[model samples]
Target: MSGIACAVGLLSSKCILSAQPQSAGRILLQYTAVRYRRKPRWLGTAKSKLFRVPERHQQVEEEVAELKRLHNVYHTQMKAVRRFLIDEVEASKLVSRAGMVIQTPEEEASEWEQIQRINEEWNRKIGEVREKRLADEREQRKNYILERLVAKEQRDQENRERVEERVRLEKELARNYITRDNIDKAIEMALVQPMSYNFSIDLSGNIRRLGEEQNQESSN
Candidate 1:
């Protein structure tokens, strides 16, 4: 009877040891599941921050470029205005010298008529100069606007490219991070993040929509 009880106790202890391994494995699996659940949220936050940094950098670059372009335009306009003023002053001096050459009243009248004709011709020329300058200004404005638009488009495209690059890197990084058991789900989640906007029409539309939404919310 004593021998039988010892064997029974030994068998029961072996069964308990076997059961403990399964329990420990179950606990480990639960911990792994919890870690898996937490990883995506943390990874998403990290990637969001990464994307924001480039966007901010892009905005600053665009603003600086715009400021420099406007400064160049300002200097060009100032130079044009200065040249026009100098031409006017020179023409006035020529008119004064011609007036001094006239002597008798008749000659003076004839000279004055010639001066008048000259003045009229000069005035017409000045008017033409002014118009040309104005046209040049209009052309510069058109060109500036076009340049800004083109630059804006390029910046937007760069942003899109950066985003794509970031996304690709994020995937590569995720691949490096994931274990064999979790790779499929990680890949799927990575692919599911929405593509961002990076075009003129989309940017304009987004701004307009934001304004409208804000206005509507404010009215409420």
Candidate 2:
């Protein structure tokens, strides 16, 4: 095609109409009118010697329809791109928020380690208490057993001493009774002797001796 001509021959090719919507529309309309020639019906008539068919206005409905289809397609594509961009932004925000809320593996591991440490410390303390308690109980039992042994020894000694004392007392009583019976027999022999025999009594034993009587007879 030839370079598109303006409806007005005076219009310059350097003119640019991108300032406002109204100006851009006017320029586009003028450009369309010139590029697609609108022919009048009375250009060739029968009076002319060389008769020719007059030009008719070409229907540009198909071009307008094609432009509309392209416009709609481009608009839908741009809308899809904008929606995708918006969704991506929202997803990024949500990901950032989730990062703020959720704990990382390292942090969770550290927390679990702290809990284990506390539990281990408590277990150690409890073990110490239990061990100490058992030691005390063992000591108490040992002391009790020693005390019982000592008490038993003391009781056994006391019982033996009492038995010995009872035996000694019985022997002392028997000796005293035998001594009294001998003194009585000596006194009876002394009293049975005649007075002419000159016998003197030894009062210490309540009895008289034969030597005293013989000595008195020899003196007489």
Candidate 3:
């Protein structure tokens, strides 16, 4: 058979074998192409290829020498062209720089005056802002100090009132305190009362005089 006929027949058979059958309305798809994977390096050479020798292509010495000479000439020509282009670019830049206008002394002085004016204006504006900021900071500091003073005054007032109230209470209680002037009266009252402290406490936390109950029974 012809090559084209054989190839078409083989492709048809491969497609038929690889075709996937579809349901009701879906189109059928077939894969007829073959893919090859590279052998892993760790696997080494195959057993069947161990004795195989690959043929090497040989070149004529004269042809190889001619090719080497042509390569050298090409590299040298390229280097020369690159160097000429770089020199031409550098020369063009120098010519451009040289063609720039040179300023007159008067023009230079005018430019310097303009730059100074701009610098002076910037300094003036910066100074104004700095002075305003400093003023605001001073005002804030003054307010803070005023507030601290007010708070300190309030605290001092509160402390003074507390001390005065405590002193008034102590003075009121001092009226009843024992002193040398009242010692004789206090002793006379103690002797008239003849108070006794011989007592016992019961489980109910009541204090009972030891002889008071007996004295009461005898009087009855």
TM-scores, one per candidate:
0.27, 0.31, 0.59
- In model 3, pairs of residues that clash are none
* RMSD list, candidates in order: 50.8, 42.9, 12.1
Tens digits of per-residue lDDT for model 1 on 53-106?
Answer: 553434688889999999999999999999999999999999999888548899
Better of 1 and 3 by lDDT: 3
The number of clashing residue pairs in model 3 is 0
Question: What stretches of model 1 exceed 4 Å from their correct place?
Answer: 1-110, 175-220
TM-score ranking from best to worst?
A: 3, 2, 1
Q: By lDDT, is 2 or 3 better? A: 3
Q: Candidates' lDDT values, in order?
A: 0.72, 0.73, 0.84
For model 2, how does the per-residue alpha-carbon lDDT over 1-220 read when each residue is reduced to its tens digit? 1122222332432333343346545533323212224323434322443566668977699998999999999999999999999999999999998888577999999999999999999999999999999999999999999999999999999999999899899988867564665988757766996355544566576455587667879999
Tens digit of per-residue lDDT, candidate 3, span 1-220:
3455445545545233355667886766665654224443544666667889999989999999999999999999999999999999999999999999999999999999999999999999999999999999999999999999999999999999999999999999999888999989889988999788899898999888979778979999
Ranking by lDDT: 3, 2, 1
Model 2: lDDT equals 0.73
Q: Runs in model 3 with CA error above 4 Å?
A: 1-60, 193-220
Query: After TM-score superposition, what is the CA distance of residue 119 in candidate 2 from its true location, in Å?
Result: 0.9
